[model samples]
Target: MAVCKGCGVTLQSTDPNAIGYTPKEGSEYCQRCFRLMHYDDLTVSMRTGIDPDQIIEQIAKMDALIIYVVDLFDFEAGMIPGLARKLPDKDILMVCAKRDILPDTLNHEKVARFVFARLKELNIKVKGLVLTSKLHSEGIDDVKEAIRMLGHGRPVVVMGRANSGKSTLLNNLFGQNILTSSRFPGTTLEMNQIVVDGITYIDTPGIEIENSLLMDVNESDLKTILPYKTIKPQIFQLHGDQSFAVAGLARLDLMECDHAACVWYLSDKLQVHRSKVQAADELWRKHYGELFSPVPLEENFRVSTIRKNLSKMDIVIDGLGWASVSGQISTISVRAPKSVNVTFRKAML
Candidate 1:
């Protein structure tokens, strides 16, 4: 079967609306890829991600060296829960992608430390961690060398959550857009195999995140939420009960706090609005999608309350970013779309 040169999907001329369709004979690229690459048009709704069970089952059965890609920005969403339990004895290499989106101030040592800490908490056991950036071609050679060293003449499997730059990283390493990659999630459908530098690399489908904030919000507002460039950390010293909204997608209401530090590490594309806790509900109910722009397009949201008893902790809103807070706030209440993947973990960074 002939596959598209851009994305490794089987080419066909029967259905124009279907995936990997090409009207012209002997076309190297699919119509979907052509439109995206040239006209910047997205003809597919990738919000509904692929099921992860098939991908996980297949990966668990492989004897290949696994390269697990992760997002530096939304680390929690990129993580596959119960992954360590599934593949306890596999040789795995963690690829932390989108390194260019982080500030230049972050050095290798600091990043490594953060990754290690997160991995430990997640219970993911990896042989090594490789940081990569498909945008700037940073750390590409190091990844290639690591693959060569750890692969040990076995097939290499590259995998990660949707939009984690798994396919983009491989494309950068080979200097070819051999796999489909986009800012939108759920691009790759099945597995695609290739040989480069005498190593067989399998590009598998991206695993779905069950409760991602990105999955619940409007598609048009995604560009604003997902950072295209480096992020500037917004740090605010606490005074009293304050409420902050991250776009219209998430509302962080600080129920109680005094002399505490609340630091937000998210995309600079998003704006943070602060108000008194008393006025939070009124403003949100009356001024949704106005002062709080990018409100949920259709999904139903729920109110979740978490008490920050830990001395230091990070509140993670899946698929968006996380906020680190010092234990000054007695309680933090979040109003977000249902299945938005909110979690509390020990402070990272």
Candidate 2:
């Protein structure tokens, strides 16, 4: 039976609105899996189609080492902790995918450190980490070399967040189309395995969901979220403690800095406005639906009041981009969907 490319469920052409509905070609999944793939609720997102528990079960069955790919742009959001905790025995080589999209000014050390720290938080032990740009073929060979060094005759289980280039990486390694891919998220729904150079490459769908940055956005907004070309970093120089919001879905509090602290490296298409940390709420209310437009009024999340202060935190507005704040003995309240991550970093600009 062919699996649905959208939800990784077994396909059935019987029901048009059901999961895996593929007409005569037949869907690749059941009805439930399909709704979860395109739905708005968190419960839908936590379903088996993209759940870490399901992925962990599959990971446990693999005999070879594991290669966990992550999006450099949305690393925090794509992280899967439970999967790592479940696969205690498998050796993991974390691959930081999509290097071409990040701003050139991104601090490499900070980025690497963040990835390592985030992986550790997920309880994933790694032999090494490779920063890669699948579009540029930057570290694909290194990934291959790492697989070779593992010396596991079994297949290499390739894992990562949704649309993190897991399929494309395999396509490059095997020089064949073993797994289908798209520019949008939730593209690869099933677990695809391809053997290359005596190595089995396991492809799994993206697990984590930071839908706050994705949902409610149309095709035009998608361009702002996942840019194909190198994004021009938008830097904002702040005098002291200040706050910023992207499309009303995310907020940032730049804590105290002795120097003129600069918050740089976000999506060029994203609109960033700077003001007093306290005025952030007012600015958002005034400009969210008008100036800094991201989501539609009716479709946006019902976030009436922002949450309390989040101190020393790094908030990445999925797709649009992320910000690393420095120079502060302060905090700011925020609110959004539970799927998005509010983290802290030591400044990677």
Q: Pick the TM-score winner.
A: 1
Residues 29-50 of candidate 2 have per-residue lDDT tens digits of 4444434344522222322246
C-alpha lDDT score of every prediction, in listed order = 0.82, 0.63
Candidate 1 all-Cα RMSD: 1.8
Clashing pairs in 1: none
Query: Model 2, which residues run further than 4 Å from truth?
Result: 2-49, 105-110, 176-178, 196-198, 210-212, 215-220, 253-258, 277-279, 296-313, 317-320, 333-339
Clashes in predicted model 1: 0
Q: After superposition, how far is residue 216 of candidate 1 from its true place, in Å?
A: 1.2
Overall local distance difference test of candidate 1 = 0.82
Measured against the true structure, the TM-scores of the candidates, in listed sequence, are: 0.94, 0.76
lDDT tens digits by residue: candidate 1, 1-349: 6887656678999998788899998988788878767775677665574678888889999999999999888888888889998887999999999987777798988889988987888888998988888767988888888887898899989898988888898888888877777777777666888898787888887888768877776677778888878888899888789898887778888867888888888888888888889988887788778867877765477888878878988888897887888857889888778878888887766
For model 1 the local lDDT of residue 177 reads: 77
